[model samples]
Target chain A: MLAIFVEMFSYDFILRALIVGVLVSLCSALLGVSLVLKRYSMIGDGLSHVGFSALAFAMVLNIAPLYVAIPVVVVAAFLLLRLSENGKIRGDAAIAMISSGALALGVFAISITKGMNVDMSSYMFGSILAMDNSDVVLSICLSIMVLCLFAIFYNRIFAVTFDENFARATGINAERYNALIAFLSAVTIVLGMRMMGALLISSLIVFPPLSSMQIFKTFRNVVLSSALLSVGCFLLGLCVSYLWATPTGASVVMANILAFLFFYSIGFARDRMKG
Target chain B: MSLISCQDVTFSYEGRNVITGLNFAVDKGDYLCIVGENGSGKSTLIKGILQLKAANKGFLTLGDGLRLNEIGYLPQQTNVQKDFPASVWEVVLSGCLNALGYKPFFGKNEITRANEQMQTLHISNLRNCCYRDLSGGQQQRVLLARALCASHKLLVLDEPVTGLDPVVTMQFYHLLKEINRAQGVSIIMVTHDIKEAVSQADHILHLHNKQLYFGSVSGYMNTALGKFFSGGGQDACNLR
Candidate 1:
């Protein structure tokens, strides 16, 4: 078994997928705690759907997917934020509107592009073998940016996420921090969509923090454990997919679900013991 | 200079005038209770002073070397905010985040400040406890400790004892009084509990029918409206 695991890394595609997967998982978990606590987890799903449409457009135009998707998704994120803040639309409703609209656009674009039929399933459900060297480099660079930005603004993020009004009253620009979260999340969602697919990427953003919350009470602990859990789950899922001939994205999501249940059971048993 | 002063402050919402030509001043170390009937804009006045809502007209200033960030505020509670997932320590420590502009993390000084405030509120043992798991009174203490961590100059609280039981309310009031008397932190509180406000506050600002009455607590009690409110008439008092 150990030799088989070692042999898997010898393949360039597998190595690239593992690197991107682990990086995406770590980035997702770092932002997930705040997003979940702030009731903004669905933004990830919304932005991923938007990314799908943007990727289809990029494919039709024969441009780099990230170049097309990043700006479009970030704009959509800011638009959603503005609408919610101005009371023009609610958060969930705005997400639903953009998400479904983008999903429809993506399908329409795909139907029109004859050559795009080859990798449609891979785009929708993700394929570990699809990552090239360029994808690995871009993912590495963007993931590092997300991590550094998150670390640099950790305390400010905590303050804004915990109580935005109070944070604003204390001279922190809550809206700016909120915008930063949205923008970074848009980038993360777009990048993860390449590996996890548009449909499954948000689970990467939600499950780790939720699982961590079951075991940890403090924000710092939740963030730290979430990072650990996310990376661990991604690696475990990758291993399972390679050994069992399953889909990588689906496998990772399953690992996350199981981890959530496991942590929840531990929390429940601890509560019982205390009672 | 007074810690907080609002001159001819007029605040409106959706074209409806909430307060027109309201004026009041809170000097350093003064416990000023703002009393008003429902729809009289007591809470709006707090918001206007805190700059959460900008005043439509007139000037509001913080003095005695106090800036907006130096004023600790305990906003009115809502159902959603109470469900936030954080520890008592995190919540309190977040109060000093304003002081760490552009810094990557909280310093040891901020942590020590949070600890001291928790000790002051006697919630040191509950530091690791989840905020959502705390009882109503304990939660209020945690919030008060958070507010304390924000500022030593002035604390602006909007109905800090709203959901507490009578015993807890009295205990909370005594705690505020101690913080005010011992530490010399100025307090500007909004409350409908005329009795408690009268008993605890040194000064009072009564808002009624677009009129502002700023006076000592005893002076306010001597007025006919104050007599009506303190006599348990309850018409002008809103517990909500």
Candidate 2:
């Protein structure tokens, strides 16, 4: 087992995947707590679909996918925020409309251009070998920035998520912080889509916080546990993928599912014991 | 000078006038209760005062050094908060976010304020407990502590005791009364319970899509609008 683990790390592509995966997991977990609490968890799913279309367009244009996809997804995220805030289109409805539209656009772009090629399939389903050195460097820088921003604005984010109206009443710019959250999610979705695939990226933003919530009761504890759980699950998923030759994204999601169930059972038992 | 003065303020929601011809003033250390039936625009008026919504016409002014952000607010609980994973300490500390300005983390001063507010609400023991795990009354206290941490001058509460049992509701009311009397914080509360409103508040602003009556509780009791709305007659007077 030790030898196999060593052999997996020896592969350069695997090493790159590990580094990026861990960072993306941490970012998603941190943001997921706020998103889930805000009832905006579907925003991640919506943004990933937008990212898919943006990546398709970038490929057709022969440009850097991150450059095109990041801005496009960020814009889509802001648009979704505005649409939901306006109340004309409810949040879930707006997300559904935009995600399905973007998904259709992505499929159309692929059909018109690559016509279901290996590269397109990799983007849709994810491939561990898809990330190059440049992608790795970009992901690291952006992920570090996301992490720092979250840490710095931690209190404000907490205020916004817990009680936006109260936060706004107290003079905190709730809208701005909300926009900041949307912006960060956009960047993280784009960054993770390369490895996790557009279809699976939102699971990273959803599952860990939910799992942590089963066992932890406080916001800080839940956040800390979610981060730890996300990273741990990602590593375990990577090992599973390496050993069993399973898809990395599916393996990671499976790991998250298992963790959620484990935590849920413990919480249920603890409640029963207390009763 | 009054802490807040409204001169012919009218608020509309989506081009429909919810509140019209609103004229009132809140003095420092005043306890004013806004009582009305549903869709009577009590909430719209509250939103107008909180600056969450703008008046379609006229002016609303804040005086006595009351900035817009300094009005502590205890809004009705949303569905999201019912299951939110937050500690009493975290929720209370977050009330200081406005004062935090560009600071990334809470300073000692903010922490002390949160602790003091928690103590004041008698929930210091529950500081580490999950907000979602608490009783409805305890959760209201936690939120009240958070609102207190935000501003010392004024508090705006919207139907604060909506779902609690009678005992907890009375306790919450008494707590608010104490905060108003002892801390000298001005309070503008919107309540469906007119009996409690008349009993606890010095002033009443009765609304029915417009300002039906706005004056001292004694003066309000004399008015026909107040008499009619408070279930009429001798029982209304007995409430006070």
Candidate 3:
């Protein structure tokens, strides 16, 4: 069994799948810290729905869905920012409005476009099984940019995520930093849509961070642990999905959740024992 | 030179004038206290100073060489911040970002400053504590330590005494007074506790009817309006 597993890891498709999974997982883990800390954990889920709408619209217009979805999700990301800043609508409400409306619009578009054939199951779950080289390249590029940006402004972004006014007072340029984060979040949502899909993407973004919070003592630890956990989950889930012939996105999401639960329970037990 | 000054600053929310023609100033090292009824725009005025709200019309100036980043502010109890999952150390270290002369990540110097402030605030025991696990007073003290870390020159606080018992409130006030006197850092604190502000402040800023009465503590005691407010009179005190 060990030899079979080792052999499978060397196969071209499997290697590509693992790489894509790890890259996307790291992206989600990096962004998840800010999102969860900002109490905007739902941002990924909402933006992914917008990605779905853009994908459907692109399908109707015969344009590349990734190209169309990028602008759409990024714009929706900005809209959420604008509304929340307008000081009338809070983050969660803004996310709800965008997510529900985008999902509805996506469904409506898919219903109307007769010639635009889509595998609904693939959209509902993810179609990581069907990724081409271009999709893999996009994931790697997006993940690298996202990770690097976080690295460059890790302190300022962490401060802003936790407290905007404080970040501003510290000369962190809260507005620009926040917008930059929102932009990256949108980009991640759109690019990751290919692998995680709309319905199941939110879990991938959240569980890794939640799980990482368990044993991590420092902020950097929490973030790094989350990234590592995400990568591990994606690899395991990819292999399991392939072996079982199950839906790829759902399998990966479930894998992440299971990993989260496992770590969460261990942490919980440790704390209880200390008591 | 005045450390901070606001001239004829009026602010409105949703087109309703919350404050009009409000004016006040603080000299270097002056401990200023603000007292007002609810909606008298105490928070609004502070928010204006923080640039959280734009005044309808006003000029705000910091003294020569006083960078905006040099100012440290603690806001009133916020539902948004209270639930955040951060540690006491994280909360306090945030203060040094203003003065660390570096980016967000802290080095040895910044950590040392954070640790020193925590000890000074008598919250060294809380260094590893979860912010939510602490009592309200403990949390406020940690936050106060954060403000202390920002720079020892100025601290602007809005109703910082909230969620504290009177004993802790006294301790908090004494700590502020010590910091102000010892470090020569000016303090501008907003509070509705008129009696306490009367005794504690070197100067008092009173807000009523969209106007201000900025003067000495004794001057505030002599005002008929002060008497009226302490009497709990219902003369637009809450509305203003």
Instruction: Name the best candidate (by TM-score).
Output: 2
Docking class of 3: acceptable
Number of the top DockQ candidate: 2
> Least lDDT summed over 10 consecutive residues: which range in candidate 3 chain A?
A114-123
**Per-residue lDDT over B38-85 for candidate 1, one digit per residue giving the tens place of the 0 to 100 score:** 878887887777788998888888788998788898887765466566
Question: Against the hidden reference, what TM-scores do the models get?
Answer: 0.95, 0.96, 0.91
Off by over 4 Å in 2: B231-240
Query: Taking chain A by itself, what TM-score does each prediction score?
Result: 0.97, 0.98, 0.92
lDDT of 1 by residue, A40-128 (tens): 88888888999999988888888888889989999998987777677767878988998999989988888887545757777778888
* B6-32 per-residue lDDT for model 2 (tens digits): 999888877888888888999999999
- lDDT tens per residue, model 2, A198-237: 9999999999999999889998999999999999999999
State the DockQ of every prediction.
0.69, 0.84, 0.38
| Candidates 1 and 3 compared by TM-score, better number | 1
- What TM-score does candidate 2 reach? 0.96
Model 2: per-residue Cα lDDT at residue A125: 77
TM-score between candidate 1 and the true structure: 0.95
